[model samples]
Target: MDVRTLEYFVAAVECGGFTKAAARLHVTQPTLSEAIRRLERECDAPLFHRVGRGVVLSEAGAVLLTYARRVLKDMEDARQSMIALRGFQGGRVTVSAPPALSIEPLARIVGNFRRAYPDVTVVMLPTEDGALAAAAVANAASEVGLTDRPVSADLRAHPIGSNEIVVVLPPGNALSGKGPVSLEQLAGVPFISSAVGTRARNLLDESKERGIALQTAVETPHREAVIPLILEGVGAAFLPWTVSREAESRGAVVLPLLPRVAYDLLIVHRDQPLTAAAEAFVATALGSSPVGGD
Candidate 1:
C-alpha cells in the first residue's frame, strides 16, 4: 500500500473516527473514507469496527498498526540520515551545559562551530548542575554536554583540561597582598561559597577534611554572584581561574590556593553515534585550550 494510504489509515485509527481524522488530516471525510476502504480491500479484511459515534481497530488493524508506525518512523529516520549526510548544511544540534559553563569554552566552541557551519543551528539547553547536564544528554534531550562532574557509566566522557581553583579576595583585603593563600590562612575567614551539592561546594567540603573550617558568610547558587560578593567585601571564595580573571578587573584579587587545588573539566555525550553537527562541535572542543591554561 502507498505510504499516504497507510498514513491515512493510521490517522483514522488514532483519531478514533473517520470524520475526526479527516479534519485532522485536512482532507474531506469522503476522501479519507475511500482511502481506508481501499486499505481494507488490499488487506482482504475490515480494518475498523463501527461503534455508535467512533470506531475501534479490528484485530487485523491492531496488528497492522504496530508495523505501520514503525515503518513510518523508519522512513523519517532515513530522511534525517540523508540530511545528515549532506554535512549538516541545514540541520540542528541541541546541546546542554551548566549555566556557568555556557559562558566560556562552551560558548567559544559553539561560536567556532557556527562559523564553520553557518547553516546549522545550535540550540543551547539550560542545566543547573553537572548531574542535570549529564541527564539531558543521557535522556536524549541533548546530543552533547559539558560538565564538571563525572557522568554515569552509560555516557562517554573526555577530560578536556583542568583549571586551578583560586581564592578570590576583596580589594585591599589583607589576604589580597599574599601571593598564594593557604587553607590554614583562610581558616575561620568569612567565605562566600557555592550552594551545597555543587562541584565548587564539594571542593570546599574536601578542604574541610584537611582541617580547614571555613566560616561561610553566604552561600549562593549563582556562580556570577561570587565575584560581586567578593567585590562588595562580603567574603572570600574559591573560584575557577578563568572566572576569577574576569573579576580581577572588577577590583577582586585572585590568588592561587596553597594546596594547588584544581578542577578537571570534561566534555560528555551518550555512547551512541553522534550526528554530523554534534561530531563537528565535539571535535572543536577537543582541540580548544583547556580551562585556566588558555
Candidate 2:
C-alpha cells in the first residue's frame, strides 16, 4: 500500500513479532499492529498466522515480504542518485555544436568542465550548422548547444562570444602579405568551399548577391579536409580565426578578411528546467573567456 506500511510489515517479518518490530522502529506495538492490519485488509489476504508467544508468516506474507524489501531498496538507491547529481559528483550532459564552434569555445569549455567535475561525462553531438544545432536542442537531442546563431524561436540563447572569419591560403600566395584582403580581391580566385548549407558557404552566397563572386575550385562537405587542401595549394578557404591560426603554424598563410566578417557565438537551450549536470555545464560555459578572434 504505502511505503510506511510496507516498512512496518517488513520490520515485523524480520523481527519475528510485532512487539519486537515496534521496539526496533520506536513505535507503539498497537500502532504497528494496526498498520499491518490495514495492509492485510488492502491485499485481502492474511499476512501472518498466530502461534503461541510468536508469529509465523502466511503464504501471502512470504510474497509481500520479497517485494517490499526490493521496493525499499530501490527508493533508497534513487535518493542517493539524486544526491550525487545535485552535488555534481555523477551524471552526464549532452551538448550539440557545429564544427567551428566546437573547435574554439565549446572545446575550451569542455576541457575546463572535465577538469573541475571529473566524474561527470560529457557527450558531444556534431551538427553541420547553427540551424541544425538549434534544432537538435529543440528536439531534446541535446541539453546544450553551441551555434553561430539560434534558428529556433522555442530556444533561448546566451551570447558567449564571436569568431571572426579569416582566409586560409597556401604558402607564398601573392595575397599573403597584402594586409586584410577585400571581397573584391577574392573574386575569380580559386577557392575550397564547404557544402552549401555551411555557415561559410551561406555567407559566400550572400556575398554573391552583392556581385562579389568566388570561384570554387573544389567543394566538399568534410571541413577537416579544407585545411589539408589549402596546404597542397588546391584552393584558398575561409575558416574561423582559431582554426586558421593552427593552419598558420603548419605553414599555411592566414590573413584577416576586409570589413572584418564575424559571427556571433551562442549557447542555446529550451526554456525549461534543466538537470543539475546541464546547469553546471551552462554555468561553466558562461564563465569561460571568449575564444577565437574578437
Candidate 3:
C-alpha cells in the first residue's frame, strides 16, 4: 500500500523472518507484523506462508515481490536523480555482465567512469551469460548490461566493441607452435568448454550443426576454471583474445582461429530514459577502445 510497507515486505522475504526483518529495518516486530497484515488485506491474499518459524512467499507474494523490487529500484533511481542535479556528486550504476566481458571492457569502463565520477558507486552483477544480463536490465535489477549477442525488442543495444575468440592449448602440446587453427583441424580434439547456452558454447553448437565434428572433454559452469583446466592439460578451450593472452603469459599456448570468431560487445539497457549515472556509464563504455584491437 505504501513504500515503507513494500520495503518491509521485501525485507521480510529476504531476511526469511519477521524478527530478522524488523531488526534490519530498526522497527519493532509488532509494527512490521501490522504493516504486513495491512498489505495482505490490501492485496486480498496472503503474501507469505508460515513454515517452521520461517517464511516462504505464497503465490501472490511471489508476484508482488517482482513489482515491489522494481518499484523500490525506481524510487531509488528517482532519489539519486535528484541528487545528481547537484553536479553528479553521488549515485550508483548497476551493471549485469557475463564473466568474459567483465574481464575486459567492463573493468576498463568502470575504471574510466570512476576517474570522472569518483563519488558514484559501481555495482557489478554477474550473470551466467548474455541472455541473463539482458534479463537483469529488462527486470530493473540492473541499470545496464554488457552482452555478446542481440537482446530482446524491449531493450536498446549500443555497440561498445567486440572480443576476438581464440583457441587455447596446454603447454607443449603437439599443436603448440601451430599457426592459426581451422575448424577441421580442431575436429576430434577435446575441448574445455563452458556450459551450454553461453555464447561461446552456442558458437560451438553452431559449428557442430554445420557438420564440423567437435568434442567437449569438459563442460563447466565456472568460466574461471576453464583456463586452469587447460593449463592442467585437460583439453583445449575457446577464450576471448584478451583472456587468452593472459593465459598465454601463464604458459597456455594461444592461437588465432583461422576463420576468426568474434563476439560483438553490446551495452544494453531499457528503451526508456536512464538515470544520469547510468547514462554516463554507458557513454564511458561506448568510448572505450575495441577489446582486442587495443
For 1-294, candidate 3 gives per-residue lDDT tens digits of 999999999999989999999999999999999999999999999999999888999999999988998898889889888978998888899999988878888999999999998999999999888889998888788889999878999899999877888888898878888888898888888888788887567767887898998888998988889989999999988878877877899998888888888768899998877889998999998888877733
What is the lDDT for 266 in model 3? 94
Which stretches of model 1 miss by more than 4 angstroms? 1-80, 208-211
- For model 2, residues 33-141, the per-residue Cα lDDT tens digits are 9999999999999999988866889999988876787566445445545856566577778899988778888889999999988988899999988788887777565
lDDT of each: 0.80, 0.83, 0.88
Counted clashes in each candidate structure: 0, 0, 0
Residue 198, candidate 2: Cα error in Å is 1.3
TM-score of every prediction relative to native: 0.70, 0.70, 0.88
Best by TM-score: 3
**True-vs-predicted CA distance for residue 31, candidate 3, Å:** 3.3
Residue-by-residue lDDT tens digits, candidate 1, 1-294: 988888898898878999999999999999999999999999999999999878999999988886676565445435556788876668777788886678777888888888888987888998887788888777565778988887899899988777677888889887766787778888887888797776568778887887778888998887778888888999988876767777898888778877687677788987866667777778888988776633
TM-score of 3: 0.88
Q: What TM-score does model 1 achieve against the real structure?
A: 0.70
